[model samples]
Target: MVRAQVLHGRVLDAETQQPIPNAQVGVADNRLGTSTNDDGRFVLSIPPAYQAARLTVALLGYRSHTQALPPLPGPELRIELKISPAALGEVQVTGLVEGIVREAVARIPRNNPARATQLTGFYRESDNDTIGRPRYLVEGLLTVFKPDYRQPGDDGDVQIRQVRKVDLRPAGQAVRIDWAGGPFIAQFGDFVHRRAQFINPRHFRDYAYRLGPGSSYAGRAVYVVAFGPRKGNSRADCEGQLYIDQASYAFLGAEWHYTAGGLRRARHSGASSRQLRVAYQPYAGRWHLKTVWWQTQARLPIGPPLNYFGEFLTTAIDTAQVARPGYVERAQTHDVFLRTTVAYDSAFWAGQTTLLPPAALRQALLDQPRQQRADSLFRRRRTGADSSTVGPAARPTPRESGRLGFLGRLSFGAAVGLFPLAGAGGELAVRYTPAGSGFALRGTAAVATPGPALATSFDYQFVLTKTLALRLVTTWLHGQFEGEGWQLGANYQRNLRPGHRPLYGRAGLAYIRQTVAYPVGTFDNPDDALRVAGTKLGADRLSARLQTLTEAVLPTLGLGLELTHQFELVADAGYLLHLRTRAQLQLDEESGFFLTRSSATINLPNADVDLRVNNQPTATLPWQPQHWLLSVGLHYRLRP
Candidate 1:
C-alpha cells in the first residue's frame, strides 16, 4: 500500500493580489497534483517519502516558483508567486480598432507552437405570430476537433465524425441534444472555420487602440474586427471585438456577432455573440493556458427565439513524445458548457500515434520470440475450468413479464361519384394492451360525407407473444352531407415473419348504424322532385371484413413500405362483392323535349388508386395530407 501526505497552498499574482485559478502544482518526483480551484486554493497529495522535500509550483501566465519545506512539515504551506515580465511574453500589439495580428503571433515561442481545437456555439430568437409573442428558444453547441496541420506533408486526411450535443427548448425549460449522428459534427466545423476566415486583419489595423483610463478592462488592450465578403470570397457571418491580455500577450476573450448572409440578401440573418476571458500561468518553465470562461448569446429568426450562456475550464497539458531521454509530456482537456443552472460536460484525451512505417511495425512484431508472441495472442483464450461444465453459474433471475403496448392506425380515402359529387372518408383507431391480459380496449372515430367527412376512433389490442393479437374497436363518423355513423367491432389478427417482412391477417365483425336527413322540396320546384321521396333516410348495416396488411423496413436505408388488402362482406351473401371500386354518374334534364331523364350511373368496383404521403404520420388520425410532394429525390451528407 502507498501512503500519502497532503500539501495545500494558494496562488496570487505578484504585482496584483488577484487569485490565479488553474495554477499547476505537483511533487517533483511523484505524479500527485491538482490545479487551483475557482477560489485559488489547491491541495496536492504527495507520497509520504516526498513530504520532507521542496515542492514545485507553476502558473501558466506567470513565472514558476519552488518553496523548500521546513525540517518538520505541517499539513499546509504558504507560497508567493512572482510575475516575471520576460517569463510572460511582452504584448506585441494592443488596441480597440485593430490589434496587430503579426505582433501577437510573433510573441508565441517558435520552439513550442501553440495549437488548439475550435468549436462554435449558437443561439437565436424565435417569432410566434399566432401567440402574438415569441414562444420558444433554440440553442445549439457545435465542436470541431481539427488536428494541427501547419505545414505541407502533415497528415491531412482526417475522420469527420465528432458531435457534442444540441439543446432546443422554450424560454424557461431545460434543453438537451442527443449526440449520435456524425454528419452534424462536420457541418458545424465547416461553419466555424468559414467564419474565422472572414474576419479581415485590415479592420483590426484601423480599430486597434491601447486601453483607455477608467476602463474596467483598462490596462488590457482591445481591438474591433470586421468581417464581410471580399472579392471572390463568400460573405462572412461574423464580426466582433477581441480583448487581449497585455502582460502575457494572450487572448483574454472576445465578443462577436454572427450572421448568415451572402452577396444577395438571404432569409436567415441574425446575430450570435460570445465573451471569453482567459488567463495563463507559467509552470515548470513553460507557460500553459489556465482558465477560460465564455458566455454566448444569439438571436435567430427561425423557429422561436433562443439564448445561451456557457463557460469552459481547461486544466492540464501533457506533451505527446519525448525527443530527448528523461523528458516526457502529454496534453488533456476537460470542458463543460452551462445554460442557466444546468451543465453538460465532455472530455477529450489524445496522444501521438506511432510514426513508424507499416514495415517497421511488422518488423517489430516479428522481432519477438515465437513462443512469447504465441503466449501474448492466446493469453485470454486459455481458461481454467472443468471441461464437463454444462450449466451457467447460480444466479437469481428476475421475473420476466411483457409490457403493455399500443398501436394506432389512421386511414383516409377519397372518391369522385356521379354528377359533380365527391365523397371523402377518414378513420383513426388506437388500441392498448395490459400485461398478461388476453383482451384489449379500443376506441375509434370516423367521418364520411358527400363533400367532406371526418372520423375518430380509439381501440385496444391485447398482444399474445410475437405472432398473435386481439383487438376491440369503437368508431364515430360525421359528414357534411351525410348525418353520422357509429360502429363497434372486434377483431383477431395473426402476424407472420415479424423480423424482415411483417404480415398481419385480421378478421373483424362490426355493427354499424347511419342516419341521413334531407329538406322537403316544394311541389312547384321540379328540380326538387326527387327530394320529396327521401325527406328522411336511415340505414342499418352489419358487416364483416378480412384484411391482410404487410409492412417491411428497408434494412440498409431506414425506409419503410406497406401494403394492405381488405375483403368486405356486406348486404346479401348472394351479391358479388367488389374488392376495389370506381364509379361515375351524371344526371341531366331536357326541358325542350317536354320530358326529364336522369343519366345512368356507371360503377367500377374495387379499382385501385395511387396516392403519395409522408413516411411519418401527423398527430391527428388519418394524418393530414401534404399539399405537394417531391418524388425521386436524392440526399447527400457532407462533412468539412
Candidate 2:
C-alpha cells in the first residue's frame, strides 16, 4: 500500500476573489469529505489507498470545482468557485419540454445515487484508418469506484483489472490518440459532471425543444426530448436528446451532438465528423450510467497531397448496477490510467471478458507508444527510478530536457481531445532542436481564418558560443491571399534557476521583411489569420523593420492541482520591439508598446488565449486595422 498525506486548501469566490466559508470538500470519491470553517480553509486526510484520487469541492449557489490530487509533497492548494448562473427553474415554462428539464434538475439529488459503490466496466476504444479500416484498438476491464453524485462521479478511483489493445497499421502511418487522456474522455459520458453548460434554466430559451417518440429502458417508459439551438441561431446551436423517466422525471440517459452550425468550428478543431451515444441502467430504483459510445473522424492536412484521415471509436459498459448496502473501501491510492505498468498478459486476458483484436493488429499494437507507456510504469518501479520531470514517471532518457528538450522532443501529451471544440478556429505547431548542439530549428503549421500554412526557422551558434546564435526565419502562408517572410537575427540565451520547470530567457535582434502580414493592432504571427477557408491580405503591402525580442518561459506554473507530467498549465512572458523603417506600423506607431498578460488559466491544455496590448500583440492583429486581438486557438498534436 502507498503512504497517504494530508491535503489542505482554501476556497475562494471567482468573482469577488475572496474567501468563501462553509464550502464542502472531499476526495473525488467519498472516502472522506469535509466542510471549510468560516475562513474558507479546511484540511482532509487521505488514506494510503487513494493518493491518486481526485479532490473536489462543492457549495450551493456556486459551480462545483474538481481536480486530480497532485503527487506527494505537492504545492499549496487553492480552489476558486464561479457563481453558478443556473436558472434554477426560473425559465418561462410555456412548454412541457422545458418543464420536464426543470423538473429533472429539481429531482436530481433524489433520483441520482449519491452512495458508495463499485463498477466492473467493460471498456473499448479504437481508431480507424482513412478508409474506415480499424487502425488502433484497446479493450479493458476497469474496476472503478463509483463516488457520490453530490460531488463528481470521477472523484471515484478506478483500477484496470485486465487490458489489451490492437493496432493494424505501421508505426509511421498509424493514427494515435493521447492515452493519458483516455482516463477522462470516458468521464464525459457522466453528463451531470461534464455537460454543466446546457443545464442552466437561464439558457433554456436558447434551445427549441420537441417531444420524440417514447422509448422503454429496462421495461420502464422514458420521455424523449429533442432539443437544438433555436432557428436563426446557427452559431450557438447544440442538438441532442434527453432520456427522462416519466414517473420520477429522473434523467435516465442523455444523447447530444452539435448541429450543422456547430460543425464549422468542430471540423477545424480536429474531427471532421463525430457523434456520442450514452445509456443508463436502473437498479434499486436509482439510475446508474450504463453504456457510452463516442465515434469521431478527422482529416488533418499535414502538407500538400498529404491529407490524413483517422477515426476514433469508443464504447463502455457498466456491470455493477448498484452498490450493496454500506459498501466501503479505502480512498484510491493510485489512479488506474497512470499506474498499471505491466505488459500484455495473454493468459490473464484469455480468461477475462475482453475485446481481442486480430493477430496482426495485436502485433502492431506492440509497436505503439501506448504499449511503451504501459510497460514503462513497473519497469521504473522495479528499479526504484521515478522521475518528476516533463514525461511520465517511467520516462526514458530518449526524451530531451531544458529548452532544447522542449524544442527538440516530440511528445503527444496529456490533453483531453474531446474538449476545447467550442469557438477555436484551427492550429498546428512543432519545434525541433537537435541534441548536443547550439543549433535549433522551429516550425509552425496552421489553418487560420484562412486555408493552410507552413512556417520554419533555423539558428546556429553565432556569437558568445551557443548562448548567442544567428538565426534565419521563413514562412509560407496559403489562404485567399498568400504571404511570405524572410528574417535574419542574433539571440542571447540563459536558463533560469532550475527546478521542476526548465525556465529560460532570451533576447534577440533582427532585420525583418514581410508582406501581407497582420499589422500592429493584432498579433505578429501571420499564421493567426489562417482559417478553414483561408486568410485574406491586400496587395502592395510591404514591411521592412528592425526587430528586438526578449522573452521568458515559466513552464511550471499551473492552477489546478492535477499531477500531470505534460505542460498542463504554464506561463510565458515576452516583449517584442518592432521599429518600422518602411511604412508605419499601426499600434507600434500609434501610441504605446504592445503589452500582454494571461492567467488563472487552466482552461484547456492545448488551447491558447492571447491578449495583445498596443505595446503587445494579441493572437491576431489588424496590421493597420482598428483594434487588437483576443485569439483562441484549438490545437491537435498528431505527433510528438
Judging by TM-score against the true structure, name the best candidate.
Answer: 2
**Model 2: per-residue Cα lDDT over 153-173, one tens digit each:** 355555555655443334333
Which lDDT tens digits does candidate 1 get at residues 195-221?
233233433332223332211121233
Q: Pick the candidate with the highest lDDT.
A: 2
Q: Rate the local accuracy (lDDT) of all candidates.
A: 0.31, 0.45
What's the true lDDT of residue 13 in model 1? 73
Candidate 2 lDDT at 358 equals: 37
Candidate 2 stretches with Cα past 4 Å from truth are 1-95, 115-118, 143-147, 152-162, 172-181, 196-198, 235-237, 264-268, 303-348, 354-563, 568-640
Q: Distance (Å) between predicted and true CA of 382, model 1?
A: 66
What are the RMSD figures for all models against the true structure? Answer: 21.9, 22.8
- Could you estimate the TM-score for every candidate? 0.33, 0.41
